[model samples]
Target: MGAEGWRWQDSWIFVSLVIAGGAGRHRRSAATRRPEGIRLTDVLATADHLNRSIPERDDVLGAVRRLAGAGLVTVTDGWFRVTTAGEQLWRSRPSSGMGTTVDTVQKLLNRRCQPGDTDWTLDEDEYGIAVQEYIVRLLPRPRRSPETAQERAEPS
Candidate 1:
């Protein structure tokens, strides 16, 4: 299918498949290796880890079905693997940021409280603090350039 048809969930699932060994081995190792596809259970685990929330089984299955229909992935004996087309599509996907840090942090917080009591809910101030802490923990600090490092070493 065209890249235009891909959704964020679909892309995430595709990536999971690829990381699970869907793309097979490198050219140099192809002769000595065989590609192993992932099972639905494994995919579910991966989704849980990535999304930080348990996803509906049907939702994941639907995404896999769409990918199969597009010839981007293949299924055999309950295992799923990415096709060459899928790899190509993955490589060509836009590198732009998909969402802001606050949005992601909020989603994570929401998931954490989904099954808990009302007392687990965060107040506005608490939520803001949580978001800030998560963002700081999640995003990497910038590195100094070589020129800047040299200048700092030399002092003002």
Candidate 2:
């Protein structure tokens, strides 16, 4: 995909690597100045910890593939490391507003019901429904066309 086509999952995976210290300059041994990268397991664990929920392994792999395809990350011998381009992308992300979706989702998922509220227990289906409701509410509504808005304003 193009540079502007980064998905939230992609940003989250990249950020997780950065947060885990798998990106940027690393302290190197005097003899061998090689950079260190984290393992795939570490990435998954870091992402899970950051989001407070387990991310699907397949989804993480998919994001890695996309990042790799974009030359943002490199995978070698089971180690994943961010490329220079990736570091640049991360550094400039604040101006591009890339992490908002991940932040919003993290906040929503981390929200807990108050102690005095009704029992927070939920079955699998109930949890699914609740999540769907939240997603629907959070998504932006499409704007109506000017003609449609005028027609509605005119009333029956």
Candidate 3:
């Protein structure tokens, strides 16, 4: 393979590593952020807690792992201090990672709803209206069905 091939392979590898890494980074960031009084294990804790309260960056775990790999944390000790750049990034970036439950649930629904259809751009109010309309018209909903008005009008 050429240089391009190597680069493409490396890109894929990076993405794979990121996927494998999970929410580690965000956890580290959170650990670093807590006050001096807070305990690492107490505040920035187990998988269940991570999954429950702090719905941070999609690649958060990877970030934490990277921090560990870079000597930011002693994994065995379960303690980490935020690096300067990480602090900068954490401060500057939007908190889309720690998303709302509603946003997350709606995202799942959006994926299941369509691929080729219109993209999900509706506001919450609009979605509520759309869903209501959809439910009301769920079975045998109106469409520009073939056949004259007489056929539909007559019924079965």
Each candidate structure's TM-score, on Cα atoms with residue i matched to residue i, is 0.49, 0.51, 0.26
For residue 110, what is the lDDT in candidate 1? Answer: 31
Which residue pairs clash in candidate 2? Answer: none
What tens-digit string does per-residue lDDT give for candidate 1 at 1-156?
A: 233344556546655665455342235332332466665555655555566754454445555666676667777765677777666655444443433322332333233222111111213453345335544555788999999899989956
* Predicted structure with the largest TM-score when compared to the true one: 2
Task: Evaluate model 1: give its lDDT.
Answer: 0.51
Using TM-score, rank the candidates from best to worst.
2, 1, 3
Please identify model 1 stretches exceeding 4 Å from their true place: 1-6, 22-34, 94-156
The candidate 3 region of ten consecutive residues with least summed lDDT is: 1-10
How far residue 12's Cα lies from its native spot in candidate 1, in Å, is: 2.5
Q: State each model's CA lDDT, in order.
A: 0.51, 0.55, 0.32
Ranking by lDDT: 2, 1, 3
Could you give candidate 3's per-residue lDDT for residues 1-156 as a string of tens digits?
111111221222122222222322545534344433212223223222324432122223333343334332222333334434323423343345533322432343233222121111224453345335434543585666656666878869
Please state the error at residue 52 of candidate 2 in Å: 0.8
Give a tens-digit lDDT track for model 2, residues 1-156.
333344567657767776565442334322342365775556656666666654555456556766676666776765667777666655444332333636542233223111111111223553345345544655799999999999999969
Per-model clash counts, in order, read 0, 0, 12
Off by over 4 Å in 2: 1-4, 22-34, 95-156
Superposition error at 113 for model 3 (Å) = 34
What are the RMSD figures for all models against the true structure? Answer: 15.2, 19.3, 20.8
